[model samples]
Target: MATPQWSKFFPDFYIERLWDKCIKCRRCVSECSYEAHIWDSKKKTLLEDHSKCVGCHRCEAFCPTKALIIKRHPSDFREHALWTPWFIKNIYKQADQGGVLLTSTGCALPYKNYFDHLVLDACQVTNPPIDPLREPMELRTYIGPKPESLEIEEVNGKFRLKKKLPPLIRVEAPILFAAMSYGAISLHVHQGLARAARDLGILYNTGEGGLHASLYEYGPNTIVQCASGRFGLHVDYLNAGVAIEIKIGQGAKPGIGGHLPGEKVTEEISKTRMIPVGSDALSPAPHHDIYSIEDLRGLIFALKEATEYKKLVFVKIAAVHNVAAIASGIVRAGADAVVIDGLKGGTGAAPTMFRDNIGIPIELAISAVDKRLRAEGIRHRTSIIASGGIRCSADVVKAIALGADAVYIGTAALIAVGCTMCQRCFTGKCPWGIATNNPELMKRLPPEVAYEKIYNLVKGWTHEIKEMLGAMGINSIESLKGNRDKLRAVGLTKEEMEILEVKHAGE
Candidate 1:
């Protein structure tokens, strides 16, 4: 089988060999799977085939004498400010393959981060800041339908609440592990996430990948996704999850289906996903069963019924132009929680065009949906979980203040487990082993090590959230949820502020 030829649009990489430091040990040649380094026995020299380099840094890091230097291939193309080097390179890449340009990890394109523009308020002389060490600060959050008001009724000669509220999944913090499918990442990574979710007392999603049997024990903290493929779904699978998420779209690839290449569908993954090994695991763009809001509602209730009405049913969607209206519909349709994945979310693989240039920012989406739900008098009926580029505790705080009941962290979690965001997940050769499924590479990242890293990351973020809450003279994360008054926008237009429902910083 011959592969299609493609022009080298971007300089794949450049390598510099320092003769003085070169030990000729060929460590670089041994480490680099790209075949970027070579040993010339005739000349007794170490040479670099830089064209093979993807700038993964595997060889450069392993060189004992540090004899090799790896750099991005210089963009020698005539510089046009209007049509940047990246734009030109992309054009050339597409021109060569005439196929969809697949990319992985988060979009590297510089998009406006709305969370950065929004500032959280702190206490002043009028309101003294509470000492977090001495104060009772609360971060526990519940995701599900919240009753507007509880009515007391006489039951068995005793006054009791008429209707108990819907079942809610409680978390110690307002951050849950975002969905990154099993096929996208490694089995060890999944194990780490399962352990982390159980240890963190939060939730980790089984992203459309189907539940690995090993993770069934972590069921109480897992949210199993039901996407277009309906992969790995059965009575046992449905019952294993504490919650069921109807994944309509993702932040990175809105209106696009997921494609796990045939090579990635190994026997284990195939069995778990109920698909044939070495076959493409393709998910459709939209759920064929769902077309209208009524259809979406029907699916949500169907999941509830399938779960015997005990599990929380969540609807996850990309932050699109009509996100607010969509969220309203989702809530009215009986979804317990709504997850809004913003434009900047990470993915295992997505088309370059859609990943870079699609979807709305998360901050704006949360505000709009929160405002719309409040106006419709159904704000309490569904919780909001915001995901997409939630980097720090500040981002989480800002998201909650804007309207999110909780935040979902994906790329950040990967980073904690040694993902460098090289944007090469599609290659199935992640150097850090977080994204790759290859047995050798996957073993480099032990489940214990990854779990510890995740625990530390979550713990650090939790403490930071508490610190911020104490500074704001608020002790509970729930108080911060949808408290837009605590947020002020900087360098935003009146229309933006109106949409954000936040005052200008000076105001």
Candidate 2:
């Protein structure tokens, strides 16, 4: 007998089809981009290939009769501490492919979630909590440099500023849509994010991918990025957005660059990214012109000069060790804002090793950077936008208390728009259509539908943030920024507490 393919024998997901409930509509067969379901005319029944399923649940969701149940496969190896099933399977996969393992989304390791270990303080007897319903709560946030002091001249009781203020980008909330490249995700998803950001009175980053011409009208709410590749960068593109970001590194793969396969580079993406339609888009690990902090400063000023100092310039870096020091340098180098992406940050595709092992959690990084900037008295010189693993309204509240001026949401936004996080984004076959470029799959998510869902998501989160702020006896988000006193640690060590600058829960 021929040896069996063990990988096929050990399927990750099992599709349970209820023959009684199934009406032969074959919707699941058509809906599944993974081709896990097959119709056998000779047998006059639908057949399943369990090995093909990536567990996206598209087939289950689209099944007209609700007959499909995608469940974890009922198979396991002997439990071992060091030799886990995933590790063993990965080794097997490598033996077959002999290539780097690739994965999508964020880190999935079972690391300690510091956000869960921290609790927010609420007003009691000493300070009564404000009622958000009865009173106004300020959630509006301003990004960019703030003047050290304001000098005023009183002219007939009318005050005017003595010096011109630096440019500032204002948002209705302390929430922003994270950077996601155009080719990495479908244009429909991009349009949805743009529309949602515009309607929500917030900003959405146009990742390393260049902005599409159709999105120029939403420039006021967009943060255009200039990565190492410098793709599609031009004079007009430089001035197209309210702010420009210099992407030094990504939290998903900090030390490496980016690669968009030639197959994904459609005409639209090619035009936007300024690369050939059938050519791979490769970004260098570092900007050739920027070898040091001083080099970074030159590029920062060059961008400012290119934009005539009209746009706010930001510098983004992964949350690595001494991130606070790096952020300090970025601010000194003339960045109006510094964005820090942490370990839990998501990506379209990344090597499995970097995604799991690199970078620190955003919670600690935010706190450390905040403490460092405040101590140096340059906190006012730049705004800090925290990202990577911000999940819900509670996470947002905790992040602000930990000292993030604002937070960016990527995976959460996608989840709002029907993403199941199957981690198949790199395959260009996202069944839900959120991360795919396939024409048929892209139709799954209409931009208008995505817009409504994302809009509702932000609106809901904003309401919850207001409630949290009111409970803390705070009427404005500004008060919550860098307010470590409003947070207390739970089940954390003294070392962790010192790093986070929070007291134990009881204390």
Candidate 3:
């Protein structure tokens, strides 16, 4: 196949060099590989190609006097209220490539985070605040089926709980690193994430990319994804992980397959993914074996039997319009847990249209799922793990209150390890070295350094969660889960407040 014709219609950005501060060091000229800067031999000065600049700020980072500045290129096109500049640029991109305009990172649309509208109730005169330092404020979370209530049975004249609960993974905090494949990010990044998961006693998802041989030691801390491609899937791989996640969809690109371009399919990635080198590895849009709830049940039970039912089986789906109904079906399908990826979820690469336009926000999805499950009396039958746009401790706390058993951290975790969210992951030339495969680029990130950063990030978030719980006079995260009474919605419509199951502020 011939390469699709494509070129930038306009210079997206330009570099501003403060000539007064420039010491003629030529660092900008030497650092930019796109040839954005060139020496004008005739005039003994530097010239910049605005079109070549991607606004990565690589040159700005290394400038001694901070003389270099990167800014959006001034546009001459008359601004249209409806047809924005970005919208116009995307039209040109597709017109050139004759393909979807792919991008990386989470949605960049101006969608309001419903999490910001919900306020947590705190202790006042009637209720006194419990200092976490003096109280046992617990953040430990377990993801899996939970018995609604304990049923006592007499065994050998001793009363014991008769319920045989399904398997669950315990973590020190409610934060779990979301799925990110080795092919999507660098091997060093995977190692760093795995190390942090191990240290934190939390899980890191292996995102449809088969487990690398080196990460086998961290198997107990892994959640291996069995995507439609069935990449690197085998009994041994299933046994290696603490849990198996049957991926139905991702939030970024719903109703579509995963795309890892051939350029990212290096020798090691090919080996791990069980795909040929230099071949695109795409996960089929739909799981051919699963079309209905029964089909889903079959896959879930099959996985349970394969691991001898030792590991919890999870189903991950993008949060769509009928997410509550979908989650209901998943719980009834015998999944131990359901992971919902909201509209703002991050991805290695996705079409711009789908990333911004599809799926429901995680905040709404979590509340809807929780309300639906509770109404059906199945909320405790399976755990709800919410992902997509979960950035900080407050987000985590709010997610639990909205009915998520635990929260998945992706972009925030990446940011903790030095991701700038430049949204050029598909290019495989990440400036911070977190998302690229090039050896030199990967060298910019060290597993040891990344491990510490991630560990510290989660550590700080965990502390903040405890502080929030203490301020609320709640000593445990369990008390916060699905506790809509403790939350009040502000600056939201009455319908929105009703759907969220939270009272309006000052009500």
Candidate 4:
């Protein structure tokens, strides 16, 4: 195969530098992880190679003098309805590379987002809205099974319940930091998530990557994951967190497993993952032991046994067709919580086809699962924790109203800490330092700094959630769970509204 000449290739981004404002500080060159800006010693100035730019905008943000301007390339092929630029470019790149096209973060395809079509209701005459600032509002949530019926007995003057309650994981807010594992992101980022989760009184999932020894101190707020790969898994590791999440499938690549290239597996990551350094960590498509619901139930009990019944066990599955039925089975299998990850979920790396094509939206999945469980009289058996492309406080509120006990924020959390979503995480060259392990790149985002950013983001979102709850005349987040009447659909079809369990806007 003949290599395409540089002149024939199309560059996605074009860089413009204002030389008069440029201080010759060489900061852009140092800041760009892609090495797009090169110092031409002979020319005595900086020269940019646009082809190397992934459009992360790190250079533009770091330019001290505001001398850099990054924008889309002006050139383009003739436009066609069928052959859009995106498709044409994708084909060109694939034909050149002759391999699977990989991308990072959530699906970029323009699918109808159900959250946008749904609107919330506010109290007015009969049910007056409460002022969150003046009155108390509850966002605290518990994740685990609730007793079918509490047995009570009256003794003397005081009445007391008879049966003991099951173990539950409590959080100050219904928002959780989703799983982004080690070897996939820098340790500094992990530390930041852990510290923030602790301070905010919530939980952060330690993706499929095994728990790092340093983060063990934050175990109370951590949820360690056990994926098919079983990287860095052990007795102590299992007990290191408040809950254990069995990652059956993630939304980003529903039917596929995970692949962390050997190059990103450093010594520290190797130790944490219990994999040899410089070896690719691949999780099999399915857990060899869990081919049936009975097999899944066995593993759930095995983990409970491993933890001595001290920690809650969660089963996470991608939101796909018949998701409600799958969730029902998982609940009956004795999982304390069921995590439903939607199609828009983010990932460090995934085949472009799978990320864009697999899984259903979390909104519909949450509603379906909640309805199925309620119909089966097992709704209280497991908490529904929704994940995938959840953005902003409104999405969180909408998710709860759709039936999620809580929601997980993955991409949004990284964005809070300077991830530009350049789709370069798989390359291990994240310019903002959120996804890279390179020493220099890692220094760009210190744990303390990332922690502060994450803390502020979640705090702001929590405040907004409270305001929304108050507006709905509901003081507790629990009241919003599966309260579909609080929401109304706009452009959604009858089927969509039915699945979401929400009424039409006028009705």
Candidate 5:
């Protein structure tokens, strides 16, 4: 293809000097999308346009040319550091904020070995192992309230309904997509998640920003989130979903307000959120209506009433130091499920310090919260959904074994498409457009292709999870939940082992 006229305006320009290695194959020109090279038949010269090069290094990677060398344009960052006001101010601000700056997305932080520190147990020679392929492997799970005990009453040769609570919501699999706000991502990304969830028979959460009109068709698969901002929340919003999540705190930016800068608050985002255009959409640190657990119960009941008690209510809280106690309070606050987010969760944008530090890890938090709830005998009453830094099928299995009824994935879902975790999503300049709000960039992610990628990733993970469960001599996920008895902690302190309630191997 011929180089387009617009290539002249490219900011960076560099020449590749291929002296002895130029085979005159013309492969570089043929392979490059930018059309930066042209064959000069008369002079036997390969004319190149340095300006049009995108620096993708496609030619360099393929080039047999030990002779070709590409160098920078030399003006990358000549400006003095002290002159950049924004950089200086942020540096000082981060210095003042002692909290590990939290962020959302996949695990952007350095990987820790907490998950490896704990090990899953399988039946040895004493017990026979179940063959997952030949025998049945049950991964079916329910996400709502479970009856304390089913009571039967004989009435005229028929059983009467004696259970006072609602029926449990069953899912074939225990994995679900966590809420990623409509405004944070484009409509296509939301649709991709919605469609993928529907295909997989799992749930997808709508962040506090509210549901887009286009996604209303996939309502059954969606769990609408109601956070402090109350964006796009209404009676209809409440009624139009499988479940409602009350977002108390996000693992990414816990204890800090979320600010959708004026630049991203375009007309559509503004309308969906019921906020003014070009205004900063801020989510306060605390829900004004919920000052206490009793007050939280009031909000929960209000939503239940608005939804006619047809949907499950979930209270999502960041995994803090005292999260176990907080989770107990949430269960008492009338939540059908508790969604816990750990420190490694992703965010659209967060201060540097907050992203690096803040909150407890999901592994520790899940173990603690599960222990607390089980001790109180409320574990089975309300489901537990753990999120933040769930990178693969192993993490999901570990989480379920640790006590989570289900696992919520955020960043992993994005990675299935094209997110590089460049950590520049807040700037709205994502090259792949998965996290940006810009129309032109957003168009890069076609709904059909994006959905397929997400579906494939989830499907792959599901199969892997089944394999892991099968290897452990387990047939069902329910048998795995809070089955810490099957797990042993290695290289942990006495206090850590005590808190985790796991004994050393051979003990």
Candidate 6:
């Protein structure tokens, strides 16, 4: 068969070459939702729009031509030493007076191995293994306050409201999608998360950017975040969610304010956030009204009053030294739950030094916070959610075993929908459109496909979690929370061992 004339204009040479090998099979074009490939009848060729290609590999996988091959462009770095370290070092020295090392993603810092050094325990010969398929395992969890003690009472000729509150909020799964602000990501990405959350029966967080009007339908599965700027905050915004999260800090830029550059503050974002167009939306590190724990509590109560005690209020803080003490104060401040974000948590943009050099690890923070809460006899009053570098199902299980009521996944969710984590999210030039603010780039991530990928990834992880729980002979995730006894420290120092309160294996 002659090569189709429509294949001549393909922007990607590789795709064009592959199109030339097509044998009139519609499989590749049919499987791709973006209509990346089209059969041109007049030209007798398969045309491809490389710009719409998300690099999902669905077409390549289904192509019978063995013709489609997606790959990264080759780099010739050695050919240009001007861009190398020595040259860059001199440039940095010359520019050092005022230049900041700008970065646009999560921490790329080398850190302590708290999560990796610790290990989980499985049943041995002494303990018979349980079959996950045959057993009933529970991953159900609640994410708010629990009663310390309950008293049964009956009213005169009537029954009073139950002393114990119907678990502040129950979740069928212990994994949730973390906050990726609307300004940082696109509307389709947010919509995808919301749809996936509804399908999976889990919750999706609206980051500090404020909830968009189009996503209000997913309210029951949404956790709206209220950060320092208080963007788009109003009576309707307050009432439009299952829970409210107050962002005190983020793991990526703990001690710094968040600056969403004016370039990305488009009309939609401006309206959603109630911020003016062409002005940087700044989120200061500390709320001006909150100077102390007491002040924090006051704000918490103010929000509670504003919402009429209908929503569960969550206080989110970055993991840092003395985070345990901070968590205790947040719990005492009347937060229904506390979200701890460790150093590796993601960001749209932050100074490179801050992203790499700040904050503690989630594993250590979770362990320390749980211990402190229990020691203070306040563990029962508030739940704990952990986010930062949660890469897999094993991470989720280990986080819960270390004492997280749930694990929040941001990067993983982005990866599920084709993010390469190139760390250029702030540039608004995301090739897959998962992180860009540009409308043309943003539209690359179609809601239907992106949502499906997220749903599949979470569903796969959930099944793996069930398998792990079954193997551990634990039926419910609650039974696993804070069960450090099931975990063993492998390569810890005396101080680290003491802090984690775990022993080396076979000791």
Q: Supply the global lDDT for candidate 5.
A: 0.80
Per-residue C-alpha lDDT of model 3 across residues 1-507, encoded as one tens digit per residue: 965444564878878999999887887876665678898878889888887887778788888999999988876579788998788778777787678788988899999889888888888999898899988888888889887788899999999878776677888888899999988998988999999999998999998989999999998899999999999999989999889999999999888999788999999899998889999998989999999999999999999998898999999999999999999999999999999999999998998899999999999999999999989999889989999999889889989998999988899989898776778888887767888887777887899988999999998989999999998999999999998888898899988988888899898
Which of 2 and 6 is ahead in lDDT? Answer: 2
**Native-referenced Cα lDDT, model 1:** 0.88
Scored against the true structure, residue 68 in model 2 reaches a CA lDDT of 96
All candidates' lDDT scores? 0.88, 0.92, 0.89, 0.92, 0.80, 0.82
* Model with the higher lDDT, candidate 4 or 6: 4
Worst 10 residues of 1 by lDDT: 2-11
CA deviation > 4 Å runs, candidate 2? 1-6
Candidate 5, residues 1-507: lDDT per residue as tens digits? 754443243335465756678887776665454566777889987887886554545456556665455565543434785654334434444565534443345445565556777887777787777777788888888899887888888899999767676856677789999888988887789989999989988889999898888888888888999988899998888887889999999888778767787888888888888899989888898999989999999999999988888999999999888999999999998999999999888888886666666788898899899999988998877999999988888889888878899999989999888775646567655556677677776777888878999999988988877777777788888888978887888887778777767787667
**Model 4 weakest 10-residue run by lDDT:** 1-10
* Tens digits of per-residue lDDT for model 1, 1-507: 665444542466788889899889998877765666888999998887765677777777778998878877765767778897777767777787788888986657777788879998999999998887898899999999888898999978999888876788999888999998888899888999989989889999999989998999999999999999989989898889899999999999999999899998888889899999989988999999999999998898898888899999999999999999999999999999999999998899999888988999898999999999999999999999999999999999999999999999999999999876668889887877888778878887899988999989999999988999999999999888889899999988899899999999978
Candidate scoring better on lDDT of 2 and 5:
2
Q: Count the backbone clashes (under 3 Å) in each candidate.
A: 0, 0, 0, 0, 13, 2
Q: List the residue pairs that clash in candidate 3.
A: none
- Give residue 100's lDDT in candidate 2 (0 to 100): 96
lDDT at position 452, candidate 1? 93
- Model 3 scores what on Cα lDDT? 0.89
Better of 5 and 6 by TM-score: 6
- Point out where model 5 deviates above 4 Å: 1-112, 154-161
Minimum summed lDDT over a 10-residue window in model 5 is located at 3-12
Model with the higher lDDT, candidate 3 or 5 = 3
Please give each candidate's TM-score.
Answer: 0.95, 0.98, 0.94, 0.98, 0.81, 0.82
